[model samples]
Target: MFASNPSKRRQMILLVIITFNIISTWLHYTDNALFLSQYPGPEWFTSVGVISAVVVMTPVGLLGYWFYSKGIFWLAYLLLGLYSITSVSSPGHYFFPMVTPISWKMHSLIWLDGIMGVLLIGFLLWSSVVLKEWRSTSVGN
Candidate 1:
């Protein structure tokens, strides 16, 4: 019945985000593989997909740990912000449907990406404000 501490809440949020991002990225890879089976994209496209996925997921996962440790929330926020923005924009056009008449199955992913982007951006902005306050308080002390 006791209220959770703010840091604990933040840790929970970070964990949730990291889990969601990992699952989403894995699903994207699965979808890509299936799509490629029928219609293989250029080699460069696949390479880019693999590289970008690594780049985005690695930092996100690391940042979540950082958040849990209460060590670098600002950096985590920045990384999440970048990931969210890129996800929304279809970074590297990796999310673009490979086949014509895109199946209904993929729709959920598109929507998820969009929603996560907005949420992450909002979280990032809120964290930035918190960071500013923390900095000011420390400076004052």
Candidate 2:
């Protein structure tokens, strides 16, 4: 459905961003920290972190599929973009502990997560422009 529109380029970009966000979110919850120091937060906070990640990421996944099927590419892009920003900022509570650990694996995961966050933010900004254009055209017609 996205093949016909000028926004297709942005749609493709957003799709990549959303796919990465979903994968990163899943990996973040599944990966094991090799050291206690690499733990994302206090001992008591890990479960909360997992749950929070699930809550946020699940909707993005679902909405992403909806956008694909309905051709609402801008909405998908916007949601995923917002999701990325929120994921990055909300986890600040845990990021420090996770990265400071002695294990290389944990450090790698932290780096990956940081990259995903940056990509998501970039996609969000680009999607916003596409969304604005879509809105203007829809309203004018």
Candidate 3:
């Protein structure tokens, strides 16, 4: 169905990547909770809160893709950007403290989430530019 529209194709790819990023976040958080890391957040930022964050953010990314598929570009852009923020912020874990060494699994999860976020942000910016050009040229025709 999306073969005809390049934007749709790009959005689909982004959706998949972001989904993985979300999963990485979930895994990292679950690991963190299990190991009892000093997560830099509120006192309530326990396992439940970690779960809640993923639960809340997952819908935002999905809804963004849904909106994009329906051609609601403005809202889709907003939600997708918000979703990207969640992933990009994963590196904030490094800024606080380094009391004890983290396992390789946790390190991998954290970097994976952050790297995916960077990819998502890059794609979003490129997509916006393509969209603007596509619109202008279409309007001219």
TM-score leader: 3
**Which regions in candidate 1 have their CA more than 4 angstroms from the true location?**
1-4, 37-44, 64-68, 91-99, 130-141
Per-model CA lDDT versus the true structure: 0.53, 0.58, 0.72
Clashes of each: 0, 0, 0
- Ranking of models by TM-score: 3, 1, 2
> Of 1 and 2, which scores higher on lDDT?
2
Highest lDDT scorer: 3
TM-score, one value per model:
0.65, 0.64, 0.80
Please provide, for model 2 over 24-138, each residue's C-alpha lDDT reduced to its tens digit, 9 standing for 90 to 100: 7656555632233356565664655665766776687668546643556577666666666534643454545445544565556656766787777765555456444434343
Question: Which digits, one per residue and each the tens of the lDDT, describe model 3 over residues 17-125?
Answer: 7778778777876776776554444444577777677789889988877776666666777898898887788787777676577777777877888888888777777
